[model samples]
Target: MQNKSIGLFLVILILLSACVPTKNIEELAVVTARGVDITEDNQVETMLNIIRFDPEADSLFTSNTGIGNTIKGAREEAADRTSYNLVEGQINLELYGKEAAEQGIFRFINGLIHDSQVSDTMKLAVSNVSAKEIFNIENPNMPAVGEHLDRLIEIEVKNNSFPPATIQDFTRVKTTIGEDPLLPLIGLVDEKPTIIGMAVFQDDRYVVDISLDEGFLMNLFLNKVENKSVEMTLPLQPFEKYKINTIGIESKSLEGEEFHINFLTTHGKSNTKVESLEQLKFKTDTYIEINLTEMSHPISIKHEKAANLLEKEIEKKLKKQYEELFKKVQEANADVFGFGKLYRSKTKDGKITEEEWREKLPYITVDFNVDVKLMHTGTIQ
Candidate 1:
């Protein structure tokens, strides 16, 4: 009787252990990337690109779609189809459609962050086209769609094509009182991933899209990146062709009641088409002036006519852009530029609330000063 009782106890323990056993690799599907968009009917839509390893078959590409009032609901719907558990840790990129961003991306992304499975390090990007288009792009030259997109991001980072903002970085900016978040805008051009420019958002709502030039300048102002490539075209005497590549821009913000940012840039020779030494020097100065003007426009120049012209141009353009961006933020009531934080830090009380800051931002003044230096003419000079 004692032996039989012991045997029954052992059997019960074995059954409990089996029920709580660890999951095997074969019972999991890895998600490489995900795309989110709002459908025409105003329903939330999501596409998950799942990857799984198989010995007998090639790696599988399984796409699942879900529609719901919220992203969580859609994710729950997607979760029902798989026998194997889906893992979000394997995902590296999250792409959002233009409509979804304009509608409000913060709510959906907040859902993703709160989910236990999602990784915080994943890269976030806004699609110039629809998220559906990005998910559907197929190029034969690339290894896999996910891998291709990942490689493209890597290349862009390496080339300094744009500032790097991971999911966590974006979340920090979004939730912070003063700062707004910016994301790179990606699109498929001829079946290839292209970094078009940048998407600026005030909280969850999309405010405005900026071109590469503007994006680069914004990056410089934000101190997000170091090295960048800039091309400036200058008119050479007697139709002599010349171009200069400006690199290594250093910027600093002034400490005062009004916001002022000063930038100093140095140019190096990528190409110069002048013959004599004097002509080379003249062309270099010309290139600097033109490029500086291109960067900033409209200032009164009484002295140092050539250099002053450039300064005025840059100052004018930058002021205009700053005003435009500030207006957009004020209208949206989003503090994407971190002006609130600046005000708080500058204030003696250090207790400016969001509402108070918003009211004061429109009245705030910003000044920009640009200085350019000609580092080298090139190998020929």
Candidate 2:
């Protein structure tokens, strides 16, 4: 009787195992990228760039758009139109339009986070024009539209030219208090995927879109991204004899609100006219001073006098720029520089709460001291 019972149980287990359905990879479509936009009527619009294996075409790109009250509803509507199941596990990029981002993208992005099929490692970006416009960019030099955007963002992040924020990072910053989020700015110019700047968000809404230069400065101050190139020009004593050179710099620290950056610069021998060693020294010093100051003025004086004037001008400009950046952050109510974090660190017992920190941040006083050291004068020197 016991042996008969064991046999019956084994048969039942086998039947249950066989009843499980196996997934057919060939019948499912893989999503590579997703774009989110808001229509004029305040409805959510979603576009998915799907990659499917086609025996006739090898790999094909298919776009699907859906409208609904929420992102999940729109996605479901799009999914229903396709014959095969959609696989979002392979998605790599999430692009958001300017209007949609400004309206608060957290609502749409939260849906992706809750979905078990989506990966949190996907990169996030904001489109300067529209996500639809970026999705439509066609370049003969690239493989596909999705691949082009992936490569462009990858290159910028690898070169330290832009800050890389994943969906996970965005979610953390969006929920965290006293901190703002920054997303890469994507531009479609002449139907090409180009990185133009960074979109700054105060909470979940987009506040300011900064140029590449401003973005670089923000990155340097935030100490998030590294590897930067700065150009410096030295004016010779006698008229238009200017020597120009580029330098690679890294941010060392934030002295109060001022940016303290260090660079590996080269000052080389130029074919330009020079009267004396003093003239050369003056021009060289002036160039160094101006570059260190972070000002955009032409060198004015002749001989050694140029060096002094440049130094003073740079010092003044650096102070002014530092003040301006702080004022901008205060007005925007976005602590992109992590001032709140620093304030919390300095508080008594390091136990200040987010609410307490916010109250004290605007009142906190910051001072900056910028120091530039000329390490090398290039191979010629």
Best-matching candidate per TM-score:
2
Writing each residue's lDDT as its tens digit, candidate 2 over 228-269 gives: 455433232322222222346552322232222233222211
Q: Which lDDT values do the candidates have, in the order given?
A: 0.62, 0.64
The residue-by-residue lDDT of candidate 1 on 1-381, one tens digit each, is 999999999999988898886866677777788889999998899888887664454646666767788876876788798766777777888888989989888888888788877888788888888888887766556434555666677666655555566788888887776577888888777777777878888776777776666565555555434345554332222111111223464422222222122233443211212223212110111112222222222222223554444445444555465557546555666655565665555557777666665666555444333334433223322
Give me the runs in candidate 1 sitting further than 4 Å from their true place.
1-21, 40-42, 142-146, 234-336
Clash count, one per candidate: 6, 0
Task: TM-score each candidate.
Answer: 0.69, 0.71
Backbone clash pairs for candidate 2 read: none
Give the 10-residue window scoring lowest on summed lDDT in candidate 2. 281-290
* Candidate number of the best lDDT: 2
